[model samples]
Target: MLDLRSFLEVCKKEGELLELRDVDWDVELGTLTELLAEKGGPALLFDKFKDYPEGFRVATDMYTTVKRFALAIDMPPDTNGLEIIKKWRAVDFEPVKPVEVATGPVMENVDEGEDVNLLKFPVPRFHERDGGRYMGTGVAIIIRDPDEGWVNVGVQRVMLHDERTLGLYISPGKHNAIIREKYWSKGESCPVVMDFGPTPLLFLSAASHVAWGISEMEWAGYLAKEPLEVIAGKVTGLPVPANSEIAIEGEYLPPDVESRKEGPLGEWTGYYGGGERSEPVVHVKAVYHRDNPILAGTPPIKPPNYAFAVQVRTTPLLWNELEKAGIRGIRGVWEHGAGGGRMLTIISLKQEYGGHAMRAALTAAGSHAAGYMSKLVIVVDEDIDPTNTNEVLWAVVSRANFEDSVSIIKGCWGTRLDPALPPEKREKGDLTHSVMIINACRPFYWKDRFPPVNRASEELRKKVIEKWVNEIPLLRG
Candidate 1:
């Protein structure tokens, strides 16, 4: 969709939208959103905040379900997670540049210089222990590479420090962080344009693990098969989504020049792993928004309730990479949401030879998409369903020999959000951690002699269900 309004209309038609009135922005708003998400509730649009003016709204849980996520990407509502991944993997890699416009609805109400008051919008304190009200959870932070001149759109946490200042936290090795350092090395500030409420397509692209030099805006356009409309920022000269709800043009000051204490907020890993620390601050030069702007909120909730409902974006990348690496007989790939969608991965493949399962596990554990912050990578036979945790666990306990099936690799790529990292290592600037690879497939030497499953065969089960449907109502389910 070109704008969030259109996406919300689709969600409403699909019975996925829920509007709430008179909600408090302090902690109640976030608490209720989390509770609903835990129970797989509908997306929320909060209006008439306890203190803020009416018409200024907040939208949360936009991608809390597979159907909603599929609609955002212009896929059929009934599309499943694996199917979406396969479709994404088949798309071309060429970047589709965004089309620039002179002006758009985002500039309908512009607050420049002294009139930049971020608090005018109801920024919610998402979690009880969050440092302050955040405005950049469901955001796209746009910056251009000083040397390459290619634009980059990324999703990073932005906490409100004041009306005209914001605290930005970009993980080390991220494209934005690398670009910001390039500016700092030249003794200059990094110009930035933050879209506080991007369309669902734009947000999905921004939050994805896109290649380093490619722009997320272009990625979104490529996926949508149409160019997104953008306008040059008045202060930063960066491309801002023309139809975005709320946007700000600012510059990230050098750490020596200015910094702010940030974090202790809940992260996607379900932990406050990145404790409070001094980070770069954004000096907002201008604020642009449409009348009655709606700020999107995507606070990180505990495991099983993630910012994105399913691992629909990255799982396909890993699967494609495995095939490209010459590994064969791949049946499926799944990343568990309980591990923040990156920490735990499960791959199911047919065993063609001895050590085949371990090879697949190692390749996946070290793959570009699964390497970062990965704690465990498990490999199962083609018979197991990787998406189902119970089946994967059963295979692990029944087939895997702990001594021979597990391998640990140390000092792999990791992030500060890893809760298992030792405090001393973190203090020493060592963000690396270990990864465990487990091959849960039966030993290939005696594959033919492996015990048969206790359940009925697929053919027999389907025939019985079809024959008993009229007599047994539960069989339909």
Candidate 2:
């Protein structure tokens, strides 16, 4: 099993890691996530922050690079994310139970009560306008099923409040939210473990909540192709990765009893929505970490950022799942850049009949974990690549006859994070929007063949490259 320590060793060997020393937390760390985004830079390691000692560090941008993405998926150097997704589709996963470890690096230090100071770590203020230092962007939160005796893990953001408390914003769609809701419903606090510096594989597995009754640690083993090693927590019964650099054990209290403002910073949607409603308060029970721990994070905002990479790798999985729904001839799918990867989806398919394309579009709109928020669904012919914006535009202009080709529906759908939606809809209540699907395929019911295209042949391209590559040295990487 690849533990957290071994994962860090691998990242170091790949020449993709950077260590930042004595960085200030108030604005320094937030600036770092942005600078790296601007440059498409490597992952960072902040060794020291404002009040923290030199030992604690924060790691960001680990999943920002393609190489890191390749590593997380266990693909070879030459393989891209699409190739990895194809492999994932072919494999039949077998869950491997975690191996219990008696001792590990995560136990090197244990702090409780007044000594538990979250500010002592290199927790970053991710954006200049953020509410406070956010310590939980890249962390995996662990929760247990009430009746099944199974542990579930998922990546969620947490806002650090003070030494003894934090603001937990568990999305209503995630397993952590359900677990916390169960606790709050009964007027009891839910025991939870937040692991900040676990293996990248843990975060990858945790990002997707497993089906009901499925253990996420076992799913981690399925992805790693080996068993994972976990250590039981000191206060919470949750099992954390044995080699994790930092683990915080806590409980989520009722929102009415404990709540506070959590954000006004850049969200994954790229806009700073005023801020999320006050979340429930978490009472920290214990903090455990290895010596010289590294805290990893990604300040979410806009396209080409952390959420984009996640959507690029994961949203495509929905395509495979849609095909299993008996939909056929799926060509390509793209979640547009605007929605922070959650709000918009565009698909190209070879439609078998009038409603096939619309069926595919709706499936992509309402699939699992998408939070029911698809702003627009555009469907085009198989000849077009959904990833190419120009092709999508061309299909829309050339084939969509507007009145005949566009299908618009209006009613209560999932429309979260859309500022344009009415206040009642943006709140817990559902919002209504005119959902349109532009059938950009040729009128095959009327015409037999599409207009021909003019392009270079594969043989001609190969001959041209063979002749000019050496002559034009700039053409070679």
Candidate 3:
């Protein structure tokens, strides 16, 4: 089965992983990671902790690059974000329920009751303004629907409160919060299990925006093409990866009365102060890990955190939704990698008739998966690559007249993390915000009247390249 170590080894063999010894777990570790991430560095594995033993390590930046993300889902090493989405669209995701085992590596060593010390791990204080150290990056939080009997797995920004407490910032209406409320409403406690590290597909699945009632475990297994090996948590009975690096089983506590200040943690939007609040705290009952466990670190400090993973998971779903909505000829759909796959979307389609592109634009803007928090939707002709910003801008500037190509509708679906929303509006369930639609495609009726690009033919371009390769220096500095 696909595990974290096996995935890291693949990245290392491909020269995409960078191993470092004795990296500090304090501010320096996060600073170095941000610098490297901004510079497009390789995956980092920090071994040789200052006080801890050698086996306890921290891994970061696993999904920052396109090729690394490709490796996560078993895609070819050279696949790009768009190509990965196309590949995902072509697959028939056979639902493979996770196989449960009696005992597994995660249970190799267990710290029960009062022995649950979250501080023992190398949880880093990433952003300077972060309330405290967060240990839940690249984590899969498992919670079951008390009524529906369906389990949900998700990754949220979680802060380590103490030896046996973690504060999670689960947004309103999110799967985890939705499931947790179902129990609280019935005067019951929500069983919870938070695993710090799993195979990349598990994390990807956790962070995806799939349809309601679809558990991330099924998505993980579908991506892996086989049932993932899982084990029941001692406290929650929820399924967790059998070979997880670190696992923490707990509950949201009975009566759901406990509350703690969490967040002000940096979000995927590259903004802070969006999620700071007094949220529900997870009371730890047990902690499990391997002998020399590696924590997968994926703090959302800057842009492009796990971009290709988001594209692969969301683009295909959006395209399918569009087709289901009867908007045809959708050549491709892409979510910007740096926007964390939610804020912006682009689509390219062949114009079947009048307002075909408009229909596609509205479909994407109002669709379930991508509509929420999606600020802009740009629809281009099939000839343009929707993923390429320059080509999209060209379409916007050349083909679209400013008056006829733009549409703005207020009070649309919005995100709580949107910094633009006023403070009063943030409260009282004012999640509704505005959205923009940019029709960048050419006019449907006057297609023949449009101007053609002056780009050279491919045959002549290839001939010129050959001549330059044989005679002149290709790059004459």
Candidate 4:
């Protein structure tokens, strides 16, 4: 079984963490995170919150760096994307059946009915323009299938509407949304438990988009190289981590399905869409927490944050999975910085023929999240590094012939998050939209000889850095 205590200890040792005492969620936590992310910083923990009872607390900025992500998965501190990909590819996950205990820290403090106050905790006002305090950015909401006895753990952002109410955004097609629909179909309420504080491996497992019929908690156990000790939920009849700091047990009923305005908050796309939309409202039935409970914080915003680290970890793994499916000569693959891991993917490949790159691009693009709005897939030559915008643009500028390189396919698929598509198309039916796969590689058949370039050896580059380190003012002490 996974021990969250041990995992957090490892994070501290790996130089990926920070602990702050007596912090507030409204302005202090958000301000600290913004400042820390700018400096390539560590995770922050709020030991004491402003309005919350003395036992209430919070932590934020987890997985802010690649080094931190490596540490989270028990990899070496210096591990890069390639190394992470190699390790993940070699590993196959086995399901872990949870061990139950009589009771644990989560039950230390319980608040029910009118006494249950969400505002008592450090639910942060993340963006300046956010309408309400968010308590679920880093939390995992647990639900069980009525027929299968299978448990689903997913990372869904929840907005704190009041002391006993929550605004949950479970878009259609998500596992939780599907489960909720099942309950609604039967004219019954869906039971759910939301875990606020969790171990890094468990958090990652919950965040991952795994295959159907797979239990996320079991996947987490495999990732941790151990079985996750999960206990049955008191309210939801679901399995939950024994060491979870806070567990808010609740239900979603058709009667409680009130339409409230959500969002206009900064999305990962770095764009702000206007107004509130109708979504399911959650009514809290019970609240559980450990002694001196610690709250977890995550800013659901644009790049250069914890979200960026998750995308960075995902890119190489996704590339590895695609290659394993038989596509070859994949020189480089990049999930574009602005897209936030959805809209665009850039690939560099060795083309066998005219449409070789296009074929590979199509396969890779559809590898995951294919039905999203306007999936832009661009393919370049081996000389280009897709991660580097400058290098990618250079290939497009020097080699890409607009007439030969560009191709567009209309009426593909789209998602609810895509602002360009109509709201109705996002929620129902296939999101038919135009898609493009641009071949930016040089036309090899026409060129007589390849261009030569001067490059430095790894050893020589290291030596040069060492030699000039003292002479370089930035490098000098």
Candidate 4 segments exceeding 4 Å error: 1-11, 113-115, 147-149, 254-256, 369-374, 419-434, 444-477
Write one digit per residue (lDDT tens) for candidate 1, span 268-287: 88998988899889999999
List, residue by residue over 289-377, the lDDT tens digit for candidate 3.
Answer: 98888888887755575455566777888998899899988888888776678778899999999999989988888887788788888
- Separately for all candidates shown, the number of backbone clashes (residues 3 or more apart, or on different chains) is 0, 2, 0, 8
TM-score of each: 0.94, 0.89, 0.92, 0.85
On a 0 to 1 TM-score scale, where does candidate 3 land against the true structure? 0.92
Of 2 and 4, the candidate ahead on TM-score is 2
Worst 10 residues of 4 by lDDT: 365-374
RMSD of every prediction: 2.1, 3.2, 2.8, 4.2
As for candidate 1, its clashing pairs are none
Rank order by TM-score, top first? 1, 3, 2, 4
Q: After superposition, how far is residue 204 of candidate 3 from its true place, in Å?
A: 1.2
Off by over 4 Å in 1: 307-310, 454-477
Which stretches in model 2 have alpha-carbon errors above 4 Å?
3-5, 88-91, 209-212, 274-276, 369-371, 409-416, 427-435, 447-477
How far residue 296's Cα lies from its native spot in candidate 2, in Å, is: 1.2
- After superposition, the stretches of candidate 3 with alpha carbons farther than 4 Å from their true spots are 253-256, 273-275, 304-306, 427-429, 455-477
